[model samples]
Target: MNATTPEDRPFGTVLVANRGEIALRVVRTCREMGIRTVVVHSTADRDSAAVLAADEAVQIGPAAPKRSYLYPPAIVEVALRTGAEAVHPGYGFLAEDPDFAEICARNGLVFVGPRPEVMARLGDKAAARRLMAETGLPVPQGSARPLTDARDLAAVAREIGLPLIIKAVAGGGGRGMSVVWQADQLLPAFRATRAAAGAVFADDRVYAERFLPGARHIEVQVLADDHGNIIHLGARDCSVQRRYQKLIEESPAPALAPGVLGRLTGAAVAGARSVGYSGAGTFEFVVDGDDVAFIEVNCRIQVEHPVTEMVTGVDLVREQLQVAAGRPLSLGQDDVRPRGVAVECRVNVEDADRDFLPCPGVLTEFVPPGGPFVRVDTHGYPGWRVPAEYDSLVAKVIAWAPDRRQALARMDRALAEFRVSGPGVRTTRDLLREVLADPDFRAAEHTTSLLAELTARRSRPHRAG
Candidate 1:
């Protein structure tokens, strides 16, 4: 890899890794920038919107992610075979995998993310926590290192105490974690968490931390160029979640303290700079009543990133491209500020009344929301087959407004406008409606477990048809 400056990235063919909405999102921007794109996919995503939109398409493997998207060597081989100059990993799968990034560089392909070393540094939440703590960031209080055994974990948790979070060293997207409320459950929790971590990431190095109950999830979006210029695109409030997975997110948290934004943003930028970070990344924080602590930083773009883009009018995907091309971030921090409130609800192919069970099939009919202040990022359409083998996410419906209430109203209206159905498919539209109408959400007094609470309170013995 050449050490060219940010403004010198190659403007040739780019291959897209991963699939679905994010893939289409990258491809559209590449076309707008006059860069040709090639789409690589597993058999399951062969009929996905991304494959149809790209200039060319290539089949890398079978339907499963492990066989296709996660196989770096095969992806690199496809890139080499297709003559693409760079590979755009649109989050998930290998987007944050440093090994894949290194492979891309070794194979003469621009990885389109931060340097591999930086990724390795930030990908491990525990290591990043210690680094940020050293860098003057307000990180959480937890095991400084990954506990080696149940006794070691118990000893550390005894230090941190009960009602703490047991986190995997290398974890993301709410996976590889467990919450223990009692000291007696430590051993069982540790064993289960270790099994989960090992099964998912092949890493069972786990740690413990004081869990912040009722904490709101806050994150800052930062973009940096190779020329040493880094700027934040404000924050997102992802407090509405279920099973530790986010369902609804909005920009400019409505309940944040007067000066909290500056603090989180500063820490986010400071943490990014600590690793000499480049490309687009998000610094996540768990917020208590008025206290904040750095949780983890996502090394790539997020699912709700479109909400920030909608309100701020910053094309994160485009900036990612330019940064990969060795181009300085076109806009500074001041220029990327939010103009209005934007809220995003993930439209998943799941039955709302059925424990959010996956409901994948061919889309018999589909129509996304559209209007002023409304943005729909999707990779599904009429006649598209919704694969059950991957994520349940089908689209992100976002709405922007000048104020929080207006944004909520607009989001409700947008949800009403959404029309998605299949021969035997169910969506979370009704559940989202319940969430939007919840008094706690409307009053801006909720946390990460709010949705699950609401769901459990209303969970019926059987699914409502």
Candidate 2:
């Protein structure tokens, strides 16, 4: 509650208002920095690794996110009750919720992120697109505002030509998004996307954009402090995705065109500074050849952030905490020297053969990969039960090396070493392995559409037999 500078204010205690590996990730950093941590969790995560690692753990509610993690009031009450000075909404639930951030500010608890107004501006896809355009950055041609109705949407689609995409103005991670490849698909796609947006984000605002199916997904990691210092920690390619969800990510975007990374990095810092941003954020773009178009800004630390950290040697979460406490960035742009290539594979507890359905069960046998250049971030253990109520991601396995080739080889070895087994348990490990070995992926010619190709060719069920 004390409005003091970061250097004078002791950020001694922090309440983690989320669960899973991200919560554990934050807790680890807080511990290393000598900051006390309180973890808020649902019944599903009572026995999770994050809870065990925290200085204190509080049961907020049941397994349902709405009643627990997403319930801002309960989270705020818990922080106040625990005497925590700040609340860290580790990605996913409430991580990008501007209202929650404002609520934290109003209740005198530091939100370990950007200001609420800044989050609102960047969180809205359409608004972010407009902001990016104003910065003189290239943005995709699309609806400047939320389309009025299906007729308006149809008209815009016709003008933009076929194969355009309808996106929820308030959506992310591919949810509330629909691709319309033909004129007949416009109405259905628009209405469906609107309904999805309302259901997920409680906002039915929809916009449209030209679809670039083969473009690579590149995003730059950005850090900004309260003092107006913003810098980028290079870029990462997350083109290996399925259903708009990234499954694999790599840093330095192997084989990028000359001067592209520099441009992307510069634009990202510019975008962040344009909004007077703070804390950790990402500027996502769709890259086609040398032309890059801004897609959206992820106003929170991302799941694929480890790839950037692996190469930059910057602990983004640590910086985020410091920035939230009003500290300037520990490193400047000149100091952010990215070295080596890093690849990350998200291990999900899903049946890749059955259209990637969630296959949750006890992990009777759990073994994570490890080596000189490999790092695994997970909250699961041998006896831990994979909860069906939450996201299927169980762990993130990352590999780093001096070059892309060695990084890929190291990732393959790490995947081979990762083991998980139980009834009804199927992971994306084998699928990721197959994708990594594909000739197109090795050549770095894969795009956001690569998952569709892999899915079509999937013939075997990946089971831990």
lDDT winner: 2
Estimate the lDDT of model 2: 0.91
Query: Taking the tens digit of each residue's C-alpha lDDT, what string does model 2 give over 270-360?
Result: 8988899999999999999898999998888899999999999999998998899888989998898889999999999998888889999
Q: Please give the RMSD of candidate 1 to the true structure.
A: 3.6
**Model 2, C-alpha of 23: deviation from truth (Å):** 0.4
Measured with C-alpha atoms, the lDDT of residue 454 in candidate 1 is: 85
Q: Where does candidate 1 clash, by residue pair?
A: 6-326, 6-327, 7-326, 9-325
The candidate 2 region of ten consecutive residues with least summed lDDT is: 1-10
Q: Can you write out model 1's per-residue Cα lDDT over 1-465, one digit (the tens) per residue?
A: 334443443566899998999999999888777777899999888888899999999998998889999999888998899889999998889999999999999988999899999999988888988988899988777888888889887787767676888988888888888999988899999999999999888898888888887889999999998999998988899998766788999998778888899999999988888789999999999988779898898989899898888878888888998888888889987676578799999999998668889999999889998888888989989999998889899989999999999999999999999999998899988799899999989998888878888888777476689
lDDT of each: 0.88, 0.91
Best by TM-score: 2
What TM value does model 1 have? 0.95
- For every model shown, the clashing-pair count is 4, 0
